[model samples]
Target: MIKCIPMIIKGVVQDFDNNACKEINLDSGNKIKLSLLTEDSVLRSLNSKEKVDLNLNQIVNFLYTVGQRWKNEEYNRRRTYIRELKKYLGYSDEMARLEANWIAMLLCSKSALYDIVNYDLGSIHVLDEWLPRGDCYVKAQAKGVSIHLLAGNVPLSGVTSILRAILTKNECIIKTSSSDPFTATALASSFIDVNAEHPITKSMSVMYWPHNEDMTLPQRIMNHADIVIAWGGEEAIKWAAKHSPPHADVLKFGPKKSLSIIEEPEDMEEAAMGVAHDICFYDQQACFSTQDVYYIGEHLPLFLSELEKQLDRYAKILPKGLKNFDEKAAFSLTEREGIFAGYDVKKGDNQAWLMIISPTNSSGNQPLSRSVYIHQVSDINEVLPFVNKNSTQTVSIYPWEASLKYRDKLAMSGAERIVESGMNNIFRVGGAHDSLSPLQYLVRFTSHERPFHYTTKDVAVEIEQTRYLEEDKFLVFVP
Candidate 1:
């Protein structure tokens, strides 16, 4: 008999094998079943009758406590996660362990809550008594509830989605990705172990169902939330946007194409190593991962040769775990296309690594298994046309100084971020993402404006009638 996975409802995990279960066999030789959510539980959350008034500080403290537990070798949370990865996901020991450690460190940061206050409410409002205007008071509150449709690319994404919701004091109902079914479950277990009665624990519900045309279930989930944050590629984002009710707001972090612009200085080999790390890390699945590299100098042969050498080094150190049939099929198709298109192709044994040198200009053709497209350009301006506002995300430039020199231009050209060549995968916690501070969007800022003596008001400081409206979300701060 196959071991059955439990379906989570309102923080309760129970056996759910009545009838509406969908069985799926993971690429890693594990068979799993997904059960439907309890209908009443879904409806009750939508109604919002049970208001959860949890203090944000306590929630942060609880997360800090959870992070501290990582030090306890016997009580480590990563052991279970690592087992899950090996059983059903494609993460190797190195990748799985790194994710667990990084997520623990991220949970320890106290700045996430501060960003909500500093970015949403003015920095002056961090202290209850310290006033931004000496008389006016302001506090950022939750938008009632948020439902997140998380992606399966990285295990830490589930933790990230929930952290933002809880920090803003919003109740959440998380829908985990099919590719990574055990990530949220492990974290939820941590929360329950610490304190089951904590309001933070009670306010969250982690559930999953097979992706299908069941509008009834998703509609109920979306209708009940004040906002929906959909983190996925184009297809997933479109699905959520279509199913969500018109009144509910949705934040779409859709598929984006990122690239590395390298100015080959004297140390050409060192430059290649930097670009190689960006390609190998995360298997090129992350939004910030560079899919294409634009080399701006002579000695193309030496750069490509060094890049191949670094890739071989990574293959031994940070090796890939497994690939599903779809990924394999994609590799085959891309290799054939590159060859037929008359592009110079360089690959390893059995398609382990493939490089298409000077491939034709295109977007969304990435094979995504350490397979990269390299382009040689006489001038950097050649890349400007491909920076489409609809899809560009990060532009990692060499030497760190190029990022500063080209930051404003890249921003204006529609790229949201410009990081150092080797640091594309790293983003500071509580920092702006996709050009907006995440906490700013997760909250609803409420102002306690003191009445100005009707006599005199400085026009410069007077409240502006118009504020920026983000689709259905209005982030208004009287200036």
Candidate 2:
């Protein structure tokens, strides 16, 4: 008899090669290998399933067990598990540890514990005060739901969606991302170690399958689930949405990009240098990390030149990943065209960085290839339109002063959140998921009771009347 638990838990565990321990190249030169169980593997897992029964009471017990175990094991003590994982995956110990720590934090924040307590206790202190408490469906009476999570690449994203489902008191069916299934599997085991009978455990199911057109598996999962929460590109979101029943609520986190603004120069040199790091960190893989920069001032061109110089200094210190090659190639292509402006773009064929001038034209030309893509703009206003068109998530204002003055305008422009230059990647990333760091997005909520309604004022229409009514009660209209 094949045990479902161990069979379902298999993953890539290879010998650590010294060369493979280097930083991962985002490009992989198209040599990327799928790490998780492919789509076929997923279907096969389901096909062999003799029984797919979940008992909520038992799952909840498991949740408690896992949550407690995670809380007991401090981050430092848990480092070894991820260190082993890095060795297995042939990645540098540093990168693996960082990614693992991030995932752990995402799974159980200090705040997450508070959130779980508040949820089980059935409190509605915060939810009552907020507007659009995030798209609710599935009547209050629904119980024991299944959540199908489609994870994204930027580190620790799975935590947000998984926690939300738990907080909502629904069982989860998490489909791990091909790029990162091991982390999720590790998380599940952590729960079992803490408490084998944690109630929440019985309610959750984590699996990975190739993307399939046939709705058989999804339909089965959906049939049992009262809610479906998915995170991915627009196409993945749409697929999940199409399969979801009207009764099931769908929270889809989709494609988004972010930029930063450099308004004034208390210290132009230092500020520009700091902004450059935001672009380059994590090899520019994060959505919130700076991709484009808007500089405002008379000597803006000089400022961009100064930024290029600073970027060069940092480039040597940071590890060269795969994306560096593509960025270098792109810089060369732009230079040949002669459209690049600012400090001399110096990344050669073998170099690991690309620094280009911000195009003066609004052709959406990005100078940095992988980690950073900076552009200097004459007016700060020009950047707003770009943000609106592409949907920027975070806009880090250089000087602290601009935070107050320009916040409303930035919000009006459609940015979901704002942050200081240094804090871009510190916050969690996903859909509408922002930095302040609440565990609400992670685990299950014990009690979520908030009323919702739209008043006439909420949907008011203002009209400038041409004429006032005289004898009659109604106003007269003029053509």
Candidate 3:
């Protein structure tokens, strides 16, 4: 069967044009025809500046309703999306279902959305109205059109990019990743399904062009962006940075590695379970996924045994996704190298998971398909040398309280986020992603200064600047 995905422009689904369509083959022997945008359509979308009159609450409410629909397992669109994920992306049945649940959770958490805005922008009302801050009224204004260059490794990332743009009130133009084009389009279709003419829906455009094939359209779109958000490997991030307008704000969610540190764990089973979840989820594709494990205390042998059991259990629960020939070959090579190096290696049945415990720090390639390298260290500080800001995004520590002791050092060493071993996927409110608040970059903070009649904090009486300067009284009010 063939699935035809149409381009969405300003809330309207475009008619499929054979001349402007790209067909992608799935591993399941099916095909997907994705609609492409032309130069004329791009200009029309750029010129159409329909204001989003809906308030923050209104947008949240609509998204919550859509989320409710997704929560229903029988929802037609939800079912189709999961089916396509299984077919096109080779996601297991359980993983596909989990992805849908995550989307629901993201949209249904209305309070979190409000909290995110308040935490990132100072106040929830900053987007809707100016709030008095210090001596002036301040508000965050959207930075016009936001261009999202999404990575397909994690579908939820694309959802997050689009959601952030909508929450910040910026118009969104998303270029779907070739590896997973269904997610963003499905999300946009849900918006249209809820209310086609809704401003939030109308404010979005989802289309795709190969990253390397067509430079003309991508460059033209990049030129119109007020902000460019790039999510993917180093090359993708560099392309977005190079092509984006010189004045545009470019936010990069580039490649970064994460690791776990287990020190004197009370319950070996519990700690093993948490570490397994971090490694198994997304098959180590996400930046927060754990790739290395550093054990600080004793019982290294016991923990390895527990970890192997947990990995086997998770393999049955969420089975690994399909890997191409190159990926399979790489996985085999890494295992062979570990064996040749005299390291302790434990693998699941049918290559479900691979674990290599090295006596020393190993610098081997991480063939990330539920593969992790473990290093046994005598002290926690020993891991510091390996942690650096330029590449480390997350450092999950077991025995939650251990974070209190090592968080400062980890932050200084370049870890962007610190969390409990199993909770890497749950990014709490008020936390900085990639060491910065992303919403801050999506909008401009504009301040309306208080009038001269308003008394200054230092000067009790209202005074004009000109009078103070002429009378040589400026220094008198300095205190």
- Candidate 1 lDDT tens digits, 113-133: 555456545562433233445
Predictions in order: lDDT: 0.73, 0.53, 0.89
Candidate 2 vs 3: which has more TM-score: 3
Count of clashing residue pairs in every prediction: 0, 31, 1
Residue 191, model 1: Cα distance from true site in angstroms: 0.7
What's the true lDDT of residue 97 in model 2?
56
Model 1 residue 296 distance off true place after TM-score fit, in angstroms: 0.3
Please provide, for model 3 over 1-479, each residue's C-alpha lDDT reduced to its tens digit, 9 standing for 90 to 100: 57788888888888888789889876555678888778777886777665676678887888898899899999888999999898888899999999999999999999998998889988888889989999999988889899999999999999998888888888999999878889998999999888887889899898988767878877888898999999999999998988999999899999999999999798999999999999999999999999999999889999999999999999999898888777888899999999999888889998899999996556787899999999999987799988988799999999999999999899899999999999999899999999889999999989999987898778787767799888988876666
Candidates sorted by lDDT, descending order? 3, 1, 2
C-alpha positional error of residue 188 in candidate 2 after TM-score superposition, expressed in Å:
1.3
| Segments in model 3 whose C-alpha atoms lie over 4 Å from true places | 25-30
Candidate 1, pairs of clashing residues: none
Which 10 consecutive positions of candidate 2 have the poorest summed lDDT?
A: 1-10
Best by TM-score: 3
